[model samples]
Each structure stands twice: as structure tokens, then as C-alpha cells.
Target: MPTALTAAYILHTLFAGVWVGAVLLATWKVVPLAKGGDLGPDALRSIESGLTTLTRLAAVVFVATGGHMAATVYGSEGLFGTGRGHLVLTMLTLWFVMTALVEVGGRRMRSALDVGKVRTAARDADAFLKAASVAGLVLLVIGGYLAGPAV
Candidate 1:
């Protein structure tokens, strides 16, 4: 049977992949399409809807799996036990904050988009998405370190 830590690692990796993959798709494909005028109003609306759906889904997975991983790895001692635990805690906290920001900012952007305020919504949404991407990358690095062979 897999150890708790092993299970946690697997769950964390899965959520991290989802988060990172979504961010990459948005940045490398979606944004460029929007910029090149290939994504007009209807297209933008559709994209925004898709983004909102995916982000929310990913955030749910992130939070649930993250909490489970933390509990499994750290137990009641929490994250103060070791260097690796500390790194994981930090990354998790950052992910939570960034996810909250994205939720709020994305909602605002959607509202703005609904009112035909394309430019403003696009700007804010882009900023939120970028922040999310950065946070996701940081978490990925920290998670990789944690999963690496212990020093």
C-alpha cells in the first residue's frame, strides 16, 4: 500500500498539473488569439465563460487535494516540522491567496464583459491570470523540491 506521503504527493502533482496546464493554455493560446483580433466579442465571452468554469474547477481540486496532502504529510504537527514541510506550506499559502484573487478578479471581469466593457475586463482578467500563472509556477517548483530525494 502507498504511504500517506506518497498519496499526498500524487494528489498534489495531479492538481498542480491541472492548474499549470490551464494557465499555460490561457497565456500561450487564448491571450494571443484575443490579441490578434481572432477572438471578438462573442469569442471573448465564450472564452471568459470557459476560463471561469475551468479556474473554479481547478481551484476546487487544488484546495481539496492540498488540504489532504498537508494533513497526510504533516499530521497534527502542522508544517513546522521540517524544511520541506515549510516549503510546502509556503507554496500552499501562496496558492490560496492567488486563487482567491483570481476568483474575485475574474468575477469582476465577467461582470464588466457582460456590460460590453471589453477593454477593462480584458486588462483585469489578464492581470489576474498572469498572477495565477506565476503562483502556479512557484508552487510547481516547490512541490518538485518536496518530492525530490531528501538531502
Candidate 2:
């Protein structure tokens, strides 16, 4: 049981970290560099491709591991009645919103690129992703605070 719990915990943390890191990189570095022409179209495309894949994978992991932990570990928190439960619920809500933003932005980017609207798509996607990044960052801070050592 302990081993299983440990594995789940590690996977959860790993994916969360990846999600945050990818968003931070996209929000801080990729956006500015790409906009200023410091990064080429190919580079921007490549970065977007990779980050989108990673973020999607991380979301899947988060859902699975988070659900599992919530069921097995924090199941007794009163399911949104208590403070911890409320925090978890809030994090989950933010996660859903972030996921939707990424999905919509990704689809828009793909459609724009298909129509040769590369610049427009990139700009639009950047805005959407930046919003998602901020949402993820807020979720990260809240989750960390909720799961702090003191907790």
C-alpha cells in the first residue's frame, strides 16, 4: 500500500512539475522570444508542438493520479465541505478551465496554420496559452499551499 501510494505521489508530482515548467517556459521565454523574432517560425512551431504534447500528457496524469489520491488518501476530507476538500475542488476546477483553454487554443492554432495564417495563429495561441499558464500557475501555488508540509 505504501509503495503504491509512493508511486502515485511521485507520478502526480512529476506531471504537475512538468505542466508548470512547460507553461512557465511558454509564458515567459517562448512568447517574448518568438514575438521579437529572436525565435524563428520553425522554432516556435517546434516549441509549441512539444509543449502541447507535454501539457496534454500532464493533464491526463494529473486527472488519474489526482483522482486516485483523492479517493484513497483524502477521501475523508468531507468532499468540498472542509478546507482541504474545498482547495482540492478548486484546483480541479482550475485544471478543467486550463485544459479547455489549451484545447481550444491548440485547435485554433492548427486550423489557422492549415489555412496559412501562421502569424495570426501564433499570436492567438500565445494569448490563449499565456492565460492557461497563469491559470496553471495559480493552481500550482494553491495546490502546493494545500499540500504543504504543515498540512
Identify the leading candidate in terms of TM-score: 2
TM-score quality measure for candidate 1: 0.80
Model 1 segments more than 4 A misplaced:
1-8
Estimate every model's Cα lDDT from 0 to 1: 0.72, 0.77
lDDT for each residue of candidate 1 in 1-151, tens digit (9 for 90 to 100)? 9976666667668867876777667756776666565666677777667766776887777677777877776765657788777887798698787677667656866787778766666666777777777887887888787777879
The per-prediction CA RMSD against the true structure, in angstroms, equals 2.5, 2.3
Q: Which pairs of residues clash in candidate 2, taking residues 3 or more apart in a chain or in different chains?
A: none
Query: Model 1 clash pairs?
Result: none
Per-model TM-score, in order, reads 0.80, 0.85
Model 2 stretches astray by more than 4 angstroms: 149-151
Best by lDDT: 2
